[model samples]
Each structure stands twice: as structure tokens, then as C-alpha cells.
Target chain A: MPGDDGLRSRFPISFRFLDRSRTVAPPGWSRWLVPPAALSVHLAIGQAYAWSVFKPPLESALGLSGTASALPFQLGIVMLGLSAAFGGTLVERNGPRWAMFVSMTCFSSGFLLSALGVATRQYWLVVLGYGFVGGIGLGIGYISPVSTLIKWFPDRPGMATGIAIMGFGGGALIASPWSAAMLESFGAGAGGIATTFLVHGVIYALFMSMGVLLVRVPPDGWLPRGWTPARAAVRPLVTTADVSARNAIRTPQFWCLWVVLCCNVTAGIGILEKAAPMIRDFFAGTATPVAAGAAAGFVALLSLANMTGRIVWSSTSDLIGRKNVYRLYLGAGALLYLAIALAGDASKPLFIVAALGILSFYGGGFATVPAYLKDLFGTYQVGAIHGRLLTAWSTAGVLGPLIVNAVADAQEAAGRSGPALYTTSLYIMIALLVGGFTANELIRPVHPRFHEPAAGAPAAGRPLTTEGRQS
Target chain B: MTTEDPAATGPHPTGETTGETTGRTAGGGRAVLMAVGWTWVGVPFAYGVWELVRKVAQLFAG
Candidate 1:
């Protein structure tokens, strides 16, 4: 058949195994296996969050300024957005195994390069290696499994995606302590840092290989045992039709979602980036001042909430519908931010609860988006659409920290302390969340003009689903 | 076409019990692979969660 044989003709024998046709799951090959494959990559790449574990050590050991030390992570975020936006289409064309392989190579090799840079004290090389190279791995690894999981678990795309994405949230949880221990063992000097990076590169490469070896695309038209398209079609936003990633971008629905994601992420990340100091500052003037260790614990709590939210809220979206869940995220999220801004240290428990709520919404926003894309655009190139959407994350990554840190720095310069330090930033987050809530409200069903023509219909816009393209 | 070729057969008939039970009926080897796959990812994830939980405990203790 052309599906299998055509790929063989295009690629050399050695590389042909990476083709889409090569990864098709065999009959009755359980779809459950795909999530673990995806998790392996996500868990490995998620180490990006633990970049801070190395930041202090990098600064002290290399005698660099704090801002200089942050360059590698900042560059990596930019690369992640850039690569995901640009490489998304290529990823769709290549399939999951190929993308995972590329991700594993770039991510691990990026770490190795950082090790080389650190060992030689060439900081630019570290930025290039970890930020530029590893960032590409992050972007590709992120979206690699999204479309496949949606395809495999059409019955539970939200939960399926949440399973993989929760790994991303949880990745740092594993890396932070592990990296700290490694740094402790090796000492925090240049030699130790280089060795730590080298070990991370090697270990992550081996761990990510599991994803490459195990990932398989569901066979065309493969549905879960009892589910049918009609069941899904009952939801107004859920479409039985497919839309190309190209056409999806042109639609207002995509842009609305872009704004929604950007705002939601900005709000959540502002607090997350400032969690430790923010909490301490909030209670600084109170009778019960938060200690340094307690602040670290608070940061850990937010991470837990972020990881847990990915799974719980996303799975809830399966029952309540994506729109309603996002309504809760944006609507209720804005209120929580407002609560923090106004209440401040008046109630410590309230402050912690509200911040955790916002963090959970942040993680949920990341996890639930691919499934939301599937609902709006169909599964044809949902991963690519998701890839495109993640530019919003990159934008918010910069915007969130800039808003909080800039404001806090200014407040401190003005001699402000306690809750006053972050009040302006908290209010800004509330406004952003309200904006996100408006954007979420504006989201409507995507116009059918963008939908790919059904098989055997007039070849109007683009090819139909992945199944149609493959056949 | 190969027996595994899904395009050849198209969508399975609705109400067919082909997914979960098929894995069970595939016998011990496939089940063993499933166990190994989940454990490989699960163990590290569990450890991370445990470590974080310990850290979070310091918050209440403080």
C-alpha cells in the first residue's frame, strides 16, 4: 500500500523507521501505552522549570551577575516559543516518533553543550547550548505527543493530554531536589556545575529514549471500544470536521483563545515567579513573619498545586465541557487575584489558598488547550495549532516576570514593604485575568469555512483528517 | 494490505468490545509490558511528589 511503501521510497532505508507509516499501532495494540511514551519526554524536558536550581550556583561559581545567570533560561523560553511556532508544521508532517527523537537529541545535547561551556567558562556557549538547543527540544517534545494522544483517546482528550502535560509540571519537582543533591555531592563550583550538567544530559537522554521507543500513532479511524463520533458531536463546540493548522490561524476563534491563554498564563506565572519572596513580603509586616524555609515550602506547595491542577481540572473539563472549565479558570481566577490584591496579609490562609487556586488554573490552562484546539479545529493538525498557540506562553513568560519584578523593584526603591511591594503587580494580574475572561467569553464555535473538506467532498481548503491524508 | 492495516478495515463497528478487553486477552506478555511502561515513568514521578510533599510539610511546621 502507498501508505507504507511511499515513505520507504522517499527516505533511505536507515531513516524510514521514523516515518508515520512505521509508527502505526497494530490491531488491538492498546492505546494506553502512548501516554507513558509522551510522559517520558515531557518529564525529561520539564527540567526546564528547575533551571533556578542552577542559577545561584552558576552566579557564585562564575562570579556573574544574577541577570547574566538568568540568560540561559530566558533564551530557552524564547527558543521554545519560536521553535514551537515555526517547527509545528514540520512536526505534523514528521509524526510523533520523529519529533520525540529530535527532542531527545537536542535537549540532551543542549545540556552536554552547557556542560562544555561551564567547564570552559564560556557563558555564551552555555546560553547557546541550553537555551537555544535545549529550548528547541522543549518546544518539539511538548507538542509531539499532544496530537497523537488526542487521536488515540478521542474519548478523553483532556485527561489524556493532562496525563502527559502534568508530567511537564511535575518535571521540575523531580529535578529541583535531584539537581540540588547532585550539586551538593559534586560541590557547587565550576567543576561540579559542569559535571552536574553532564550527568543531567546523559540521564535525560536515556529517560527520553523510552518515549522514542514506545510511541505509536493510532491506526486511522481507530476509536475507543464504545465511543462514536456522534456522541462527541452533541457538544456544540466539538466538531466532527477537521481544520488545517493554516486555516485555524486565520480564524478569530484562534486569536481569542490566544489572548485567553496569554492572559491566564500571565496571571498564574506572575505569582509563581514571585511566589517565595511574594509570600514573605506579604507577611513581612505581620506578627507571623514567614521564614526563608517556609517561603521555599510555599514555592513547593504552588508547584504541587500546579502539577495536581493539570490532572484534576483537565479531567473535570471532560465532564463539564472545555468552555465551562475555562470560564471557571478565567472568571474565578480573576476574583482570586483580586482577593489577594485587596486582602493581602490580612489573612494568611486566604492568601495561600488564592495563590494556589491561581497556580492550578495556570497548569490547567496549559494542559487543557490541546484538547480545546481539537474541539475547535478537529484533530487534523491540532498539535500544530497548539504549537502556534504556545507563542502566547512565551509572550506571557516575559510579560509576567517583567510586570512583577519591575513593579516590586520599583516599590522597594520607593521604600515600600509588606503587601505594598506586590499590590500593584497583583492588581495588574487581576486586570489581565479579567481580560482573559473577556477573551474566553468571546470565543465561539469556529466557522465551518475553515474546516477541511470531508473525504470525497470537493477538495475545498485542505486535506481532511490525518487519516485521509495518510490513505 | 497487512492484517494490522486500519484503513483496510475502517472504523470498528460501534458497541464492539475491542479495546480494554483486547489488552487483557492479549495475554501475559502485553500485560507485563504495560506494567513495566507505567512503572518506569510512575516511580520517578512518585518520588518527586514525595519529595515535594516533605518540603510542603515544612510550611505547616513553620
Candidate 2:
């Protein structure tokens, strides 16, 4: 009876049971071990961002239209959201090790399938393989380390999550140049692309295996050195009660954040998907003709900005607070997009700076949201909630490209040129950013109805009569 | 008896609880494996990407 009471006392909320049952590391083990475990998975699956590097080759080799070539990347994004949302609860139940292992399998297999598709000239296979299967990996791998890292570094959740999230951004830095070289060596034809896919499958599988093997949950009753519940308890960001993943979806905060994330992503990805073409169009009539290689470099530079922003801006959130940081991202991001629209390609420097700024905020939005969720929903079932929220991302993945591409394609058909094509699209992104900013402003403290009462309290004020006890 | 005294407990006389020891070892193993494993995993991935880039450049040049 005492042992049962002790265990119950240790976890005031049902969701905290997951945290309570964890296995804590020994005294001698360094905390530094956590990042690599995170990086291993992140670095491998982060290849999703680098898909653009393959766009040129795929376009030339398959003789596919631009929109046609984008299907794989766009669909992969769609799948990433779907898989993450659907798999989140399972991920939380099974633990990071299980989730990451599954991620590695799906992602690598996706590559293998895509390789076969390319070899056989079956374009649909590439979409099914990379977009559907590999996307499942992206979603799972993305969230696998989140709950674990938050648990391991409760004292510094933002910093811990930032380190792992940074890998997602940095993944492209390595993948871009490497993918280009693979295309060069093997030839960018179907055969060459196939070989590259084969290499990606084998390499990422091996890399991600490290994360699967190394991940561990902290032991019950273990707190980070020099920290306590009492200290963490007072912060407005800390949640004393746990919300089940199911009840979490019912909360207004969840939907509000969902809208925020979706709109923010839509705005950023609009420019990103069309960065190369947009740059060329912006400078076409000007004396300064943007060369193809230079435009490619511009895309690469935007990628660097995106990746670095994940680390720099998100880590900065720990100091300024999540809501405040997002204010900068959404608010300033709208202004930047407006600048690009209004500047009319007259000032190349302004265009580049604005584009980079928007991309940075885009990447920062991803890296910061996990920590933001931690602040709102207690870590009890955060991975699951994070997963559900990713449905928004899936929506944006499709929506962003469609808006940019459809608008541009339409404009081209209408015989527009020299910055005219993207003007309407830029305005749309600005509008989405404005909508996101409004949602961020609307986020209020979660109603008490959502909180699970502390253990031993009479459940009089229970939020939902049925799930209230569980919350 | 003092709450701190393991001998005073009515259960097994062993000084250490099974949970305590198991937790320690498992945590330690995970830490070591994670650090060393990531290094091993990262190296090959880095090399693979490097190889891909080298090849792509060659294709363009030749």
C-alpha cells in the first residue's frame, strides 16, 4: 500500500506516470550524451529539407514539369504531418527508442523504393516512396526526441529541444551539396538518381540507428541537478497538471497554435519553394541579371539562414519567452514580405535580406513550437499533442506550394514578367502572416477546465466530467 | 529506526534496492552508447554526403 501511495504521490497527474517510470542515468554519465542521440536521428531524416537540391536534376532527367517534379517534396510534407499526427500517441506510449527505430526503417525504405522507381522510370513510385514512406520517417523522427529531451532536460527544455531541432535545419546544409555531387557522378539521369537514392537509404539508416540505440528515459523521481519542482512550479510557463493527448486536442489553445503554425509555415514555404525562380524573375529586366548559379547560391544562403535561425532564434526564446519570440517571427515576417512586394526588385540587397529574414523566421517557427507546447501543455503527453498539431503542417505543406506555384503559373500564362508574377503570391503570404500574428495575439492562458487536479484533491472543479479526472 | 537506514526496512537485507541499481546501470549504458553511437553514425553519413557532392561535381565538369 505504501509503495502504491508512494508511486501515486510521485505522479500527481496520470500523464506524469510516463515521466515517473523513466530510467535515470547514473551519476557519472555526462548530460552531453543527449544531444548526439537527438542529432543522429535529426541529421539523417533532416534530408527532407534538402529535397530542393534534387529538384533541378529530377526536372531535367524525367522531363517533368516544375509542378510535377514538386509533387514528391510536397507530398512528403503532407505525409510528414499525417504520420506525425497519427503516430504521436503511439510514439508517446512506446518511447523514443521505438519511434526512432520505426522512423529509420520507413525513411530508409522510402529511399530504396524511390531508387527503384527512378531506375524503372516510374515517377509515381518516387512520390509514393519518398513522399509517403519517407515522410512517415520525417514526422516520427521529428517528434521522437522531443518528449525525451524535454524530460531529460526539464530545467532547460528550450535549449535541449533547440539542439535537436537545429539538426533538422543543418541536415540540408550537408544534403544539398552532397546530393548535387551524387547527381554529377552518376549522371542526373534516372540511373544516376537511382544510385543516389540507394546511397541515401543505406547511409541514413545507419546514421539514425545510433539514435534508436542510444535513447533512454530518465528514472522515476529523478530531477536535473540543482533543480526542483518548487522552483519550476512558480513559472507561468510550467503546467502542474497533465492533459491527456485526447483532451488536449479539444482545447482552444491547441487549435489556436495550430492555426499559428500553419499560417506561419504557409507564408515561409511559399517563398522557399519558389526561391530560385522568384529571384530570377525579380532581377530579370534589371541591369543586374541574376545568373542561374547565383540564384542557386541564393537558395543555399536562404537555407543557411533557415537552419541557423532554428538554433539562434529558438534558443533565444528561452530568455524572451515563446509568445514574444513568435511575435517577432510573425510580425516582422509580414513586414519583410511586404518589403519584397513593394521594393519591386529595384533593390537586390533589400530583396535578399527580406527573403533571408522570412526564411529564418520560418525555421525558427518549427524549432520554437516544441518548447511552446511544453510551456502550454505539460510534458506528460506532449509528443502526442505535438504530433496532432503537425496536421497543420501537413496542411501547409500542400497549401504553401500550391499558392505560390499556382499563382506563379497562372501569372506566367497571363504573360506577366519581371516581378509581376510573384506580386500576388507575396501579398497572400503577407496576409497569412498577418492572420498568424492575430492568432498568436489571441492565445490566452489555457482554461482551468483543461487542467488535471492535483492528486488527493476532491475533483469538484473537474473540467470534463468524463475526461476531467484524466486531464 | 531512522528512515535513512536501509537495515531497518522489513524487506531484503541487501543494502541496495533493485530499482536503484538497475536504473543506474541502464542510464549509464544509454549515455555511453548514445555518445559513441552517434559519432559512428555521423561519420559515415558525413562521408556519404561528401562522396555524393564530389560525384555531382564530376558529372557537371566531365
Candidate 3:
């Protein structure tokens, strides 16, 4: 309720014109423009993945340990999960324009403020700036375009969401080398890092504003040319019935999907977190072993797989259906993990292919979940629901690395080395994937009781609610 | 059952949903939005893809 006009009133007068609630797309506007708007924000915040580029420099300049230097990025992730959960409803209420603007300001300002922190050598300032303020921007920016995209492309929610989420993964790929080059050019000192932060802030703010100007919500009941709601609803998992974000969370389907995402992500992160070292260990005894540079290359390849999988797999979900697609992700993913576990560097090519497939599913898991949410919960509060669901990711982020790293450490201590170090972790991941597959299999159509009753149909179990909020 | 309701027959059960802007594109505005949209989405996306390709190339080149 506080989000409606209250959120809009918080912004300065000059910015009100950009708010989606007040603005209108000109006559003859194409729905095609919406993805760019969503991408603009995603590409900007996706820089979170590239924070490692700054880590070595920060540790060197500040004389901080690796763990200490990583605080900003870690806290940024924690805050991303927290703020998205808290601010999700507000974003839904205030509209995408408002959310995008807030994200742009907070995200850019986080960089600017972190620059100030670096110039002064105040580590806490960097932590607060990038982690707390910028993290909110990441969370809001992530969800801002999702529901709108789902609305515009009701026929292809998975595909629509995939394009935008792929930007987040790609953002890191672009920013990693770009940020590295900037630091190199400017000199990898405190001054150089500060300058990079400033440039990033200014550039991202400018880039994200494009989305602010270009994005508009589709008019009510608008469908793509030659599309009908009935056709899209034909799938077994899809429902024409809408559920509010608030109530959607109460449903068993939401938690089942939540567990599904958590396990899938946790399983994938096991490999992603240790790609470089794991590859080196697996092939150390080979005639032409994996070198450091090649190990780094292997890591880069995984990133490519991550980005490609988001677009390819999620888009595929649109055709084959979300449930069936996830069946492939978790089902195939488990088998791949099993393959790696059993093969145990017996064949290097087998390890590479299996790992790539796993990473692809990792990225696909992210791009596809929003559509899954839209299927179970209507677009009314899909953004908010998605926000809540991201806690699964946050949970997995910690769980994944912990399980993998912890197991690897234990193996080394026990005098085990090479492929055996990862053997147990791989089996664990397989089990987790199997768990996710079962959860996915358990998903059924949301019962009629949860559906917002149609007006002409007469109010059934639930009241005639629109946009998930009861009028 | 509400599932059989005429209102449920469409995308939104209530028929009139809030924040729905029926964007009608005519000849000129539609063309401009299309060009602008593609360029806007395409540039950054292409750049990202290009960077990724180059990185992978470097990985193999080594």
C-alpha cells in the first residue's frame, strides 16, 4: 500500500515524468522495445561478478587479507538478497520506471561513494557504499523488468526473462576484461581503482537511463499480434488463474520450486567455484597437463557456457515447456555429475563436456525460474515473488561454495589428492540435483481455490482480485 | 467453476488491470521504436558477446 503513490512521491519532481504510473507509451509503440530497457539495468548491475578484478588491487593497496578485501562483494550479495525481498513489493507498486531510476541512482552512487572510500583508504566506506547501497540497486534492477517482460510476451515468459538475465551473466564477461584493462591503464593503485569506480558509476548511470526512457508496461489485456491467452495457457503447468505474490508464497508449489532452485544452484556452484584448480588437479598426471594459463582459459570457457546456457536453455523452455525443460536441467545435470564422478579424469574430454553442461544448467536455472514463478503466480506480483525466490540463490551461493570448498579441504587433509578430492563433492551435487528433480516433478497446477476469481464467473473461493492486490 | 467463467477466458480475469498500457504502434513511431530498441539492446549485447569471444580465443590461443 505504501508503494503506490508513496514511493512515487519520494522521488524529486523532475523525475516524476519518467514514472511508469504517470507516463504513457506513444501511440504505435512496439512491445519489442521492452527487453532493451530490461537489459540496460541488468548489464549495469551484473558488474557484481567482476568485483574480483578489483580484489587483488584492493588487497595490495590497503594491505588487507584476501578475506577482508572480499567483504564488499560478499556483503553486496547478501544485501542483494535482503533488499530484493524487502523492496520487491515497492518495485511492483511504484512501477518499473521508478524502480529503474532508483536502481540507477543507488547503483551509480554506490560506485561514486566507493571511489571516495578508496581515495580515503576507508575500507568500511567501500563496504557500506558498494555492499549496502549498490546491492539494493542490484536487487531492484534484477526484478524491475521481469514482470513487465512476462506481461508483454505471455506466449514466451521463459524466453523473455532469459534475454534479460543473460545480460547479467554477460555483464561479468564484458566487465571482467574491461575493468581489468581500465585498472591496467590507470595503474593498479588506490587512485586507479577509484578512477575506475568513478567511470563505472558515470557510464552505468548513463547506460541504464536508456531503459528508463524506453520501457513501458503493456496496456491491459494487450497481447502480441496473432497471440491469444488461451494458447499460452494450454500447457499443464500454466494456469490462466492469477495468484498474488503474498499468497503465492503460501502455496506449496512456491517452496517446492524454491528448494528446486536452491539445490540446482548449489550443485552447479560446486564446479564453478573451483573450475581453475579442479581442472589442473584432474589432469596433473597427463602427458600434456593443464597449465595455469589453460586453467584460466577453462574458467573463461565455463563463463561462456554460463552465458550461452541462459539464452539457449531458457528460450528452449518456452517451446518444450518450463517443467519439461527443468526436467532436462536437473535430470541431465545429475547424470552429468555422475559421469564426472565415475570418470574421474579417466578422460579429460569427458570432464570438460560434463562440467560445461553443468555450468549451462546453472545459468539456465536462473533464467528459467522467473518464468516458472509466472506460471504458478500471475504477473500481478511476479516481480515480488521472484524477489522472494532469490533468497534461494543467496542461500545456494553460500551453500554451494561451502560444500565444495569444505569437502575439498577435508580431502586434502586426509592425504587424498587429484580427482578423488572432488569425487565426493560430485556425488553430493548429483544427489542435490536429484532432489531438485523430484521437487520439480512434484509441482502440479495451482488449485482453483488459490486463483483470483473472474468477475463474470462470480466470486468463488477467493475474492475478485486484480493485479494480486485486492481492490 | 470460476475456471469456466467468461472473465477467466482472457489474460486477466477482471478484464481491466492496472498499469496496463496498450502501446499502439502506427507506421512512423513503430519504425522509430523498433530501430531505437534494436540498436539499444543490440550494441551492449554485441559488445558483451564480442568480449566473451575474445576471451575464449585468448584462452585457446595460449
Candidate number achieving the greatest DockQ relative to the actual structure? 1
Runs of candidate 2 with Cα error greater than 4 angstroms are A1-24, A52-72, A116-127, A186-193, A229-237, A413-415, A453-460, A463-471, B1-62
Provide the DockQ value for model 1: 0.30
- Among incorrect, acceptable, medium and high, the docking class of model 2 is incorrect
Name the lDDT value of residue A226 in candidate 3.
62
Q: Which lDDT tens digits does candidate 2 get at residues B1-62?
A: 00111122122212344477775686667556655765664664466445444543432232
Q: Which wins on lDDT, candidate 1 or candidate 3?
A: 1
TM-score: the better of candidates 2 and 3: 3
Question: Which ranges in model 1 have alpha carbons more than 4 Å from their true place?
Answer: A1-9, A459-470, B1-26
Q: Scoring each candidate complex against the real one, what DockQ results?
A: 0.30, 0.09, 0.21
lDDT-based ranking: 1, 3, 2
lDDT of 2: 0.77
DockQ of 2: 0.09
Candidates' interface RMSDs, in order? 7.1, 11.2, 8.7
Give residue A29's error in model 3 in angstroms.
0.9
Predicted complex 1: CAPRI docking category: acceptable
